[model samples]
Target: MLEEELVELRFRLGDGSDMGPIRYSSALTIAMLKERIVSEWPKDTKITPKGSTDLKLISSGKILENSQTIAQCRTPFSDLPGGLGSGGAGGGVITMHVVVQPSLTKTKTEKKVDDMPKKVTVCSCTIS
Candidate 1:
């Protein structure tokens, strides 16, 4: 396939740093893109995603669904959100923002009832 036919993509972190000008087929799914992002994630970043489930990809103010294709998520250059532009030499690169979502397991810890101290109240009855 010709280079122009492929979609050029870049990933931007919450810190405003960018990842790549990697070329991909428009047919690629958002889930697949997340996998790529996880693999190419920078080691120096303070926040890291443990898996695709921990990452959220946003483009043009829309959070891309896992089932959505690259083509579906792309927007016209003029309509690009967040001041993003068509970058790269060819000028069609789409910059997607990557957000690391805290996992439910990490954010919500279950406490065992047995671990808590029981409170006991003594009832006193007085009869005249």
Candidate 2:
């Protein structure tokens, strides 16, 4: 089955250099996703977002990195004017959407066997 997802992002830089908003993607599992999120955060701080979207309409909430929660968000984009405009100034808002597509192909060890016999006999049990 095909798997797709949408994620909310919070581009926060305490330094206030105005890096602007960013949309990121990944295929890591929820466990890995949580790990990555915390690991990527400054000093591994887990963000407890209070609002789903920021003052700039950017998202700042909990999101599933392995599901379809992202479809609810619009795609074309409504980029904020501030911090990204000419001369890019101070502190920007949080409002960005990221799409993550994960591949689900089976590994070699899990591949289907086409040459296996319809029935097989083991020492004490019969296999089919």
Candidate 3:
């Protein structure tokens, strides 16, 4: 594929910071993109994704599915301001929002609570 045909993408975190202005093939799948994101994730961030499953890629106000390709997720140039009649490497770079949602698993402290002994109450009744 020609270099001009490649899609340029930038990943934006919740903090409004950017990851890359990297070029990828239009045929690249969202799942593949997630893998790349997990590997290239910034180490400085307090919250990091454990795996690709923890990532959600949102583009153009829509959540991109794992099966979707770069071309399918790309926003039309007309929809962007100052993006008319542009294509290829020099064209506007699409920005995708990356959300890291960790799995809801019980922590060690929670497990310890379950292991604790239950309180016992003894009631005594006296009848005359």
Candidate 4:
């Protein structure tokens, strides 16, 4: 039997930051990859992904399907996510863009703010 091939992939954030050239089996599904990304996201960042559902991965200008594998989503002779280097097939790395959807709570907060009165002041008066 042939050895299982391992591929490296990087997740690029909307802020232009790179997550990793994390290794995975060529057969790994997109859904599993997303889970890995969520777990690996930097805690230092202000934006935290609530879950995998709020994240989307894009490659070659296309959104990757959850059912697809690492091999299915990569391009040939591509460089690693953080300018690490370039390679082909087994050692090559694929870069995928991470898009974070806005939190639903933020929209609700905005609406509440909009509905509130714009101005409020207490007045002091003396009658003589």
Candidate 5:
């Protein structure tokens, strides 16, 4: 797990909506966050969940790929409706979602395979 913490950025909707952005206080690592959300999202699927608090990650217009690398962290409300790269929000002052990316100081180790050869022995040879 990374040492960084993730927080959601909230924003208000349009059409006289009073709801702010729903963000998550990420107490998890970046890999865990991606794993939790990615597994539930289908390919080229847009999913919307009830309530602004819960983000379905994939929306109807969002395109997701298996080969794509998951960014450890995302800006607040980055996945919210009209949050990022959308003109619907009209470029207003939106709160930020702060997510912690995984640290790069971890070391990986590999185990070596045994070099012993297999031996076969038979007490007596049987002729069939």
Candidate 6:
């Protein structure tokens, strides 16, 4: 397998940020890409995904598998935008949509109650 066949990939996050125009070999796996995304994720984001399991990479309306390669995911030049490395050799940037689905450790009710102040007040009244 020739590693020279490089393809640029861009990951679009939920925050409307493009994570990469990073070059990857056609042989790179989707699982590997997820790992890269997790590592490159912005620290400033409030909600962080626990691991690669929390991520989903979609291309051409299809959710990519861990075993799948960049070559399998490559898109045609006409479909890519200029910023996604549409100029050079191999097919244009294989833009992938990233969906972060972090597992919820607590329920909605738990979150709501946790935010409430735990204070008690007593009122005494005299009636005639």
lDDT of each: 0.80, 0.35, 0.81, 0.77, 0.34, 0.77
Task: Report the poorest 10 consecutive residues by lDDT, candidate 4.
Answer: 82-91
Which candidate should be chosen as best, given lDDT against the real structure? 3
lDDT (Cα, tens digit) per residue for candidate 3, span 1-128: 64535777899997788999888888899999999999999999888998998889988788999999887766455566655225564566788899988645634566789999999999999999
Task: Give every collision pair in model 3.
Answer: none
For residues 1-128, could you state the per-residue lDDT of candidate 5 as single tens digits?
74443344342222222223433334444334345443433334333222222332232334223233222223333566654423233423333222222223221111122344557786897899
Q: Each model's TM-score, in the order given?
A: 0.69, 0.24, 0.72, 0.66, 0.21, 0.66
Q: What is the Å distance of residue 74 in model 4 from its true position?
A: 2.3
Judging by lDDT, tell me the better candidate of 3 and 6.
Answer: 3
Per residue, candidate 1 scores C-alpha lDDT tens digits across 9-83 of 888998889999788877789999899999999999899998999999988788899999886776455465543
- Please say which candidate is ahead in TM-score: 1 or 6: 1
- The global Cα lDDT (0 to 1) of model 5 is 0.34
RMSD of each candidate? 7.7, 14.9, 6.9, 6.7, 14.3, 6.8
What's the residue-level lDDT of 51 in candidate 5?
26
Angstrom error of the Cα, residue 75, model 5: value is: 10
- Residues 6-25 of candidate 2 have per-residue lDDT tens digits of 23345444343223343433
- Clash count, one per candidate: 0, 3, 0, 0, 8, 0
Q: What is the lDDT of residue 78 in candidate 2?
A: 33
Worst 10 residues of 2 by lDDT: 49-58
Estimate candidate 4's RMSD in Å: 6.7
Overall local distance difference test of candidate 1? 0.80
